[model samples]
Target: MGTGTDTPHGARAHARAQHGTRTATMPVVPATDWPDPPCAAGHLVWAETVAGGGYTHRPVARGTEIRLTDLQGDACAHLLLHSQARPWERLNVADTVKVQWNAYLRTGRLLLSDQGRVLATLVADTTDGRHDTLCGTSTLVRNTRRYGDGAAHSATPAGRELLTLAALKNGLDARDLPPSLSFFQGVEVRSGDHGDGDGDGTLHFTGSAGPGGSVTLRAEQDLTVLIANVPHPLDPRPAYTSTPLEVLAWRAAPTRPGDPLWDATPEGHRAFLNTAELLAAKDPS
Candidate 1:
């Protein structure tokens, strides 16, 4: 349709532009401070530094180990996980707490889904084993009230808002979000004479994890992981304070029947069985 002189030149230029933009890209920003011997053999799949009040999301294959490190003690990493194949199956915080028969988090603990399958397992914890599930991520309203500015680009962004954006990038919306788990921060429950039966207990924000604290979770299934590095909602500090967070993930094998974590508890053992059943169905070979 165009002039004969212009047609050939225009087609060549446009084809070059399209090819450059369509190429696949991967991010690799290694952290020199943290020495991971296991990662060297497994080969690092992802390495990133999420700044304070920032967020990130990605889909990983089964058997990937993700370690979140609070580069500085003040960072709080709010995390969420969902089954990539079946987005409806998501992290159920209540089931994770009830089925495990414990409200506290530590090594060998399983993160369960509402469907009774294990989504991930805490393989390593460098902190005192204190993490918070009762207090979810910060919100725009709360962050605005506390820090006077809660916009995502502002100095103090709400974790919920940040996660909402991250979800959008992954073809999800705000409604898809569930309760999140926070690392590098802790909460303590105190009950009165009522004996915690009436659900009357004080939830106290103990504090943040010390410098360079970290936790590693092994994915039991293909997963979509979302993380927001922000301050805890219950942090009493008037001024907004947060630090950088390090995210590292590498190839690894999921827990098996003989593994210590798999045989640690009856409830967890059953959950792992459920996960294995589902995974096997997806890939018979």
Candidate 2:
């Protein structure tokens, strides 16, 4: 394990060197140049903030690269992606972890669907590669137990409300909302007698993002995205204050032969090939 100061565990450059795949936080897009947004180059697609429990929904197409910036340090964006073509083909959290053989996600990891298709790739993460997919969105009961009066309509809304509202906008009743990816959140899994009585061990969510630190993902397929900047359930913070986060989407160029995500892993390569073939069959040009 590299020292926290010099190299973090699974640092992007290290991931690339060891795995023959690129992994490093992508550069931050200058907010100065695109202050008015939608950029002078016409790339910015969508931007919004959900205060703690607020929610927003977006639909973006393939080859669209979106950058997620942490305007403040304590932001935790609970994200879910569904297929624009087939909403049923949403982000399958379990498949992503099991197939990739990783519990934590960072730049260079591919988000996989339950149907064995590539949904998106984590291109850059400035938050020390600490995103979580297991802990999932925070809940009312858990929040109420941990911090009194946790409700969507309450002064401090719950994280689950974000997913519920976003799912509703997607035209589904959301009887089964899948687990979500918690960006800008870090969770360390430990095995021992946690004393919680569940015998499931314990998860300690640590670390926080710095202002302007960001993550980026290049869409491998057209995606129906739902977002909310809610705190992680394991967040040790006293209040439900959510840091403001930003999203910037630009028209992504075509993927080249040497794309990092395409070569990140054996499974990643296979998934990319499958994606390319599918997209090509859909449009030969």
Candidate 3:
């Protein structure tokens, strides 16, 4: 009897020929058109691209392992988050800045924030110190004419404008809405001190209603109201008005089981969960 490691060369060769020559079959699973599982917290999900460039849903919490098989390919996704009635403050673009230096001590890198916070640390890279801020994907625009009535529009109105508008429609009086509305353009209202911290001001949005309805909006910090008078042209119906702030608040406000919209299909609720799970697994701390 010969020990496995002490077998004769010819015997070893024979064994290798018999065992190594055999090929194994890999199981093939067909792709399904179902949404991915949801994240653990139920706040995030994942989406995979389906036929026709559309996305199929998945939850991030499913613990799926995703790999970028094609090293040369790029992954593009949009991210939106809110925290305490404001945009999430953690994610910042300036954290990836690279600084360059001379050969002896080539590059220097530093992450920056608009308010001078460090969002990330550049551990290593081929490029020299100091990355291009203009070229980076993380960019924040505080005030741009593009967001104005003419050139651009946000799917959801927020920030100072929304705050001011909410105040006005809630009957805070133009005088009370002034401070918050002054910086914005195309807003009109009275000016006075209502003694409501920074003086309440009104913010307004003017535009012809689209297929949905009218387009006038007013808001204050805690309240927001939208007024649209454009009836469906064909129906010749009376102008309709809506206070989206109330709806948004209801959707975002604290409640049992949270807002259903957070889990709704069209909102890509599952995809967000997947993203969160992926991020957690990556442990990009």
Candidate 4:
């Protein structure tokens, strides 16, 4: 991967970070659309194209493997995860950041819950690690100020609105909304002055997911997933524009201690243990 630079457009304050990859647990499905998926293995569960600015939601099994493809360059998928059995126990971005001790999520990073359970893992990111969790998603207020009020609900409503509706479909409401994990966007932090004036510290959306560039995840728990196919909060596009995203899911093989995600870290191991206990109690099996 190449380092990013600060320019008139949004970008990370620094250059690119070294990229990483991992094996997929499912077979690739070429017929389901988003041809030439990044993952070599994974059968298609179902595929959906979230129109730019539109939002969608779905329920996925614990062992399902997921792939998100940016059919066009520069797309954002603001995602949130929740336990299918317990809606309140959803993704905790703070826990994910603290447990990993890194703000940037890469392949092998665990997405944890507030109860310290593993939700999912970033098994692959084909955009050379250009995804971002820092810039977040755009909202009505934000879009109105940055673009205009009319731009708020055209196709890409604020992430909050989309997520709220997505969650409501799964028996959750606004208060249930959690901070999301952003993908297909990358940001760089910068300080000091640029040519015009004081630069201070700033994060620029310098990352872009080129065509066929993809990210894949393996769900460690049954997940109620919300997706916002909206522009990244920091996108510098001339207009409030976003591109469609193709989401693919497949059945996954049972994970063992030797699995990539299971052994990613000592904390991951313990987190899975907790998740297993919770699932077992729910199943009585």
Candidate 5:
């Protein structure tokens, strides 16, 4: 009497037994117990090229310390900062030094901003005594012409472009930047008498844009004016394509010590020179 009726229940029990045999719960291992392998040397996902430049996405968060080393003696490295994914803003060398000095003198420690922001701190300086903000980053063309733009040239991504791309990725409009933003190629700055009458020297911005209406920018100011290449607040389509067939030329040769490029109008050069000197004087041991 039970043979046929109990057969279904027996099959179900057998299926359950098979499933339990195949499935076994295992304990999870703690992350600390299993550490990841060390990264390979020079296996950097992010690196700045001299020709292209470099930039940071977020503000050097409060308490962050950046150590700048003059890889090559007398070589100048340009640094820019941004807050909340806004435009890249130049850090006043003097402001940076004051912060550094106050920190060292008061606490025998490095400085920090009111917002807990710590700009770059010169941990070591084997090269030049100071870095120049006025003398911005060099471009691809500048390196090519100076070092023979051959395959052997070591190219770096432009910092300005990196900043622009970072902003765009974070949802900023490229066209909003003021005309002073210069990138990829250079533009000519004419006296106000000419139709191009902005007191600011010609601005050049180099980078790409997408059909989705985003832009990347790498810009430079002409003549080292205070207002040169400053990002403007407004939205407008960019002047150049995201990528072009031919490379643009530099408006002037890259800045080098004692070069005409550094000899921008006496007043402009003086402002930058003074700032550089102040920064050097405030250097903490």
Candidate 6:
């Protein structure tokens, strides 16, 4: 019933309204914008913060250092890795634990792929080596039971669902998803044979590394890294509580022949060799 003109009012009125809306829509930039500074000056390549219960995925080049920081200590950064060149060759948690002869991850440990190649190396850690590869990310059913709702857009989304979204964005699907590693949360193996005189151990969810804890890993191969910041499956808290996670990546040199981690173990040494062979054969740069 009104005029079909581009502006119902005059051009001046529309300009004034648009200016007011833009001013209100824009956020104010403060001096203390960055909570944490870069690890190294002038070398930061990428930085992002994944809100609690959020998911993110990115392709990282070889020789890059990726650091995941638990900004408030309650964040469980569920992580999955895939080789960029060969997506089929993804992280194998069981192989990583078996090949290293240690279940607990720490600095100098290597994250191995299913094809017996090194995907990433733990070059730095501030969380007392607290990490888990056994207990995978949270599921929709589990989160629904724990927090009432687990839809992708729900208040409490499951890590699996969130990661599925991330995977789909990267040209992958649910079938490509495997078990993931969780950083900032500690799961210990305790002897369940108390007074039973048996040799058995069970997983115990200890908790996260207090606030400000972080871990850094160096990519050994070009990797597609997927992360979901959510509550750990075994977290005992009754409330659905999680904190934000900060991710920072920078340019760095990959491991070389004289690097300590490369020769830290004969098994790891062989894994590094396998990684090098693949890179050399594929790129040879």
lDDT of each: 0.85, 0.74, 0.23, 0.75, 0.28, 0.86
**TM-score, cand. 5:** 0.28
lDDT of 3 by residue, 1-285 (tens): 564546797677667767533222111122221123222333221222211101111111111222101011111111111111222222233222221111111111222222232222222222121111221111113222222221112332223333333334444432332111100011123236646443454322221222222111111011122211111111111222111110001111111124342243332243334434544565667
Model 3 has an lDDT value of 0.23
TM-score of each: 0.85, 0.79, 0.19, 0.79, 0.28, 0.86
Model 6 sits at a Cα RMSD from the real structure of 5.3
- For model 1, what is the C-alpha lDDT against the true structure? 0.85
Best model number under lDDT: 6
lDDT per residue, candidate 5, 1-285, as tens digits? 233335887667666666523211111122122122112332212122122122323223322222222222212223344333233433344443353432111111221222333222223222222222222443435434444331212333333344445456545544422222222122233335544465465433221222111111112111111111211111123321122111111111222247342343443344335434533565534
The deviation in Å at residue 191 for candidate 5 is: 27
Ranked candidates (TM-score, high to low):
6, 1, 4, 2, 5, 3
Clashing pairs in 1: none
lDDT ranking from best candidate downward: 6, 1, 4, 2, 5, 3
Most accurate candidate by TM-score = 6
Candidate 6 overall Cα lDDT vs. reference? 0.86
Lowest lDDT 10-residue stretch of candidate 2: 20-29
Off by over 4 Å in 3: 1-44, 48-85, 88-91, 98-133, 136-285
Model 4, range 155-260, lDDT digits (tens) per residue?
Answer: 4468877888888898999898878978887776565766746366677667685777788888888888899878888777757678878788877754656776
TM-score of 3: 0.19
* Candidate 4 residue-pair clash tally: 17
- Superposed by TM-score, candidate 4 places the C-alpha of residue 83 at a distance from the truth, in angstroms, of 0.6
Candidate 6: stretches off by over 4 Å? 1-36, 192-199
